[model samples]
Target: MTANTHDRGAPAAPARRSGLGVALFLEATERFSFYGMLSILLVYLLDVRGLAAPRANLFVGSFNALALVSTLLGSRLGGVVLGPARTVLYGCAIQFMALVLLGLSVMWPVLFLPAAAAVAVTNGLTRTNMAVLILRHAGGGRSADGLATLYTFAVNLGAMFSFLLVPWIGRRHGYALAFGACAAGLFMGAAAALLNRRALAGGASGGTARAVPRAVAETGLAIVSYWVVLNFPAGGHWIFWLVTSAIPVFWAWAWRNATPAERPGIAICLILVAEAMFYGMFDEQTTSTFVLYALHDLNRQFSVAGVTLFELDAPQIVAINAGLTMLLGPVFVVLYRLVDARFGTVALSVKYVCGSVFIVIGFLVLCLDTAGGAPGLRAPWGMFGAYAALSVAGLIMNGLGLSVVTTYLPARMRTMSVAVYYISTGLAMYGGSVLANAMGIGRLHAATPIPESLSTFHALFRGFTLLAACGAGGIVLLLPVLRRLERRAG
Candidate 1:
């Protein structure tokens, strides 16, 4: 494990595992509440609220970007004055209130935008606090990977509930009811943190300034490109369930060794080319093209709940991936541990690559199912296969891969580094939306029936296939550079 001056004055471990468990529970609840809201957001805005697709997507992306910034700012404040635990509690309160307001916004309507932004702020603060708590609980490096994977599992579980339950319920009751559910979740999450406050605040006493050299800072800053490449695809996946987003994030991180500045420019250029290909290939499943196909070309049903409940549209189908992850999360973790034990450190890169490959294959499966319009009939089940692959792939890609990045990055750059990592993801989401818009998928109005969207699906998939190819090529080109850098750094 690597060391930083920050570890020097850290205190002794808490006397009881119960205390740590309480903290973990609080953190996990917070993740659940936040992701629960996120799981339903895009569909809510674009479908239920009667907003334009592009505008809705743009709003969601902008809000997420703001939240990312808020997290960085909140982390600094938590580190210095309020401390991580207290800041987390504060964030919880904000989240609770924001969710309540969001529910109210369903009635007021004009307040929805602000309510969404407030949720972002709450998440920013909450995530920062949870990060600090996680590191503290792990006692530096001991359980870093396990903790990260667990946190992600909790998030995916929360998302799954929101995706599966909320959508089904919302179809009958209305979007407002869904927001109310999220509000309840936020309150529970906040209450959990409040209950565990005493335990989380027990450690870490004094804060001391440490000197960091400019050269090292520069090296860290320069690494943002790699971070961006890694996060872009993941972000797309999360925001839109653009499962293809996994391609860039996983490939970049797996090929991290090749990212050092010592590598030749031509080699790096080739790597970027491949990354672009992978990203393109991966994007098809999430774009409006997919949405169009699901509504128009595929067989769909409406629920007989008397309220006109739509049954399993494309967005909802993508949302089901969260459920798949939740069910399989623990199993994946155990399998991952076995692999890690067998392969040792190389397991990290292996998981990263495997995750990306899974995502690529998922996209390929999607292309095959819909490519020639088999029977010229819509099969929602085909999309289900793609989403299932994505869910499992995301477990390997983001869940395991993020652990490696968080642990491997130097300490001084940790928070900033994560911020950069997320920023790339944010940008890619916005970029994918724009690209989808260019292909005419983003302009679809609620009144537009599904049958008109099949071509859009085909176009989006073709683009995604190209992106995946590029990302794969990027990994190959960066191989020599990665080998050299690994030898030097490792």
Candidate 2:
């Protein structure tokens, strides 16, 4: 659960909640499907398609951005066209189709991009709906705690499955079979929802079939328009510029619409958004470039807390990060409580700052250990530390994003502000793709390894460290001002 939910104190009235098991099940399954697809994507692109590393990174970024941005459109339509429950059902079906295309890319090399777009739209449709469904039945009080508990558990559960199952299959079997397994997982989720249709009932009133076709069309059009931009020179840069320009505009409109009291929170949101672009650069890499590095370079013999585990392939070892997060989750909870008792309430800005710190440390760990050469069989533990640190960064940032807007931003501006944040993520994803290209990730790949190209990859890691340091430093420099703003906003 997020720090906000954790710190909510005891329930005003204790009561049991049910009917959310189906939503949580869907949540777990959706993440499993999404991350599972991604776990093998970069390696698949490199080894199977013979695409250059930068090109593959751009491919993932462009399509992933579409999916993240589509959630906005999905939220509006999911409530009506099919209702949240049915919308999720439809989305799972769509995702299954996408995965089928992805799984079979060996035969049809041309379908990957289109398949990616479908995946994004599917996530956009279902991601928010799961949480909304949970909230609908949560009512309030301890049931709300139930919501937090379920949300956290379900997310990690899905990631755990993705990291453990999907990549292992891809490493041991083949990409096609691995993707087929993900498809099967999605189908099982759909089947579960169908069998327990009673538990899945009672979402937004289902709208006409016409409504869904239009919604899907509009969303598809958005993706097409976004994809069309790939033709532009300096496409990633211009896209980043254009997307970020919307942030202040959003906050400006929101600020004017909000009460005088809400302005400070909006101000804080803008700061968080700015700093978050850097966070995106690293966070997105955990999926793309990092996984690729592991595949080509890092040692895959795995262990945790001195217990040796199996000698998994690099892609398979990515699951270990998910496992590590599960192990550390409780440690963080207890640490948060202790810190709260010892130092008083931790400010949201502080959380972001600290998150940035952890992230930078993670990057530095990797950069320092890999300074002189390609990572091949060198600095094995550093990547593991990097993964662990990044996982913590993920939790802190997730908490900040999930709770900050609702807890701080005025209710009137919450939705739009949240949209601004997510839209920035799309921009940042593009920016990250740009950086991946910039950082010489293009030089590192499978099927060929230039020993001298180690310099290029090392520069890339240093760039990551520098980007994270600068972003976090900016947040730190302005830390006092943001804290005051938070107090005033509250």
- Candidate 1 lands at a TM-score of 0.75
Compared with the true structure, all predictions reach lDDT values of 0.56, 0.69
Give the best candidate by TM-score: 2
Alpha-carbon TM-score of each model against the true structure: 0.75, 0.85
lDDT of candidate 2 over 299-413, digit per residue (tens): 6666677677666666666676677766666566666667767997577678888889998899898888767644456635777889889878866775356455555565445
lDDT, candidate 1, equals 0.56
Query: Candidate 2: misplaced stretches above 4 Å?
Result: 1-16, 79-86, 134-153, 194-210, 220-238, 303-308, 333-344, 372-376, 445-451
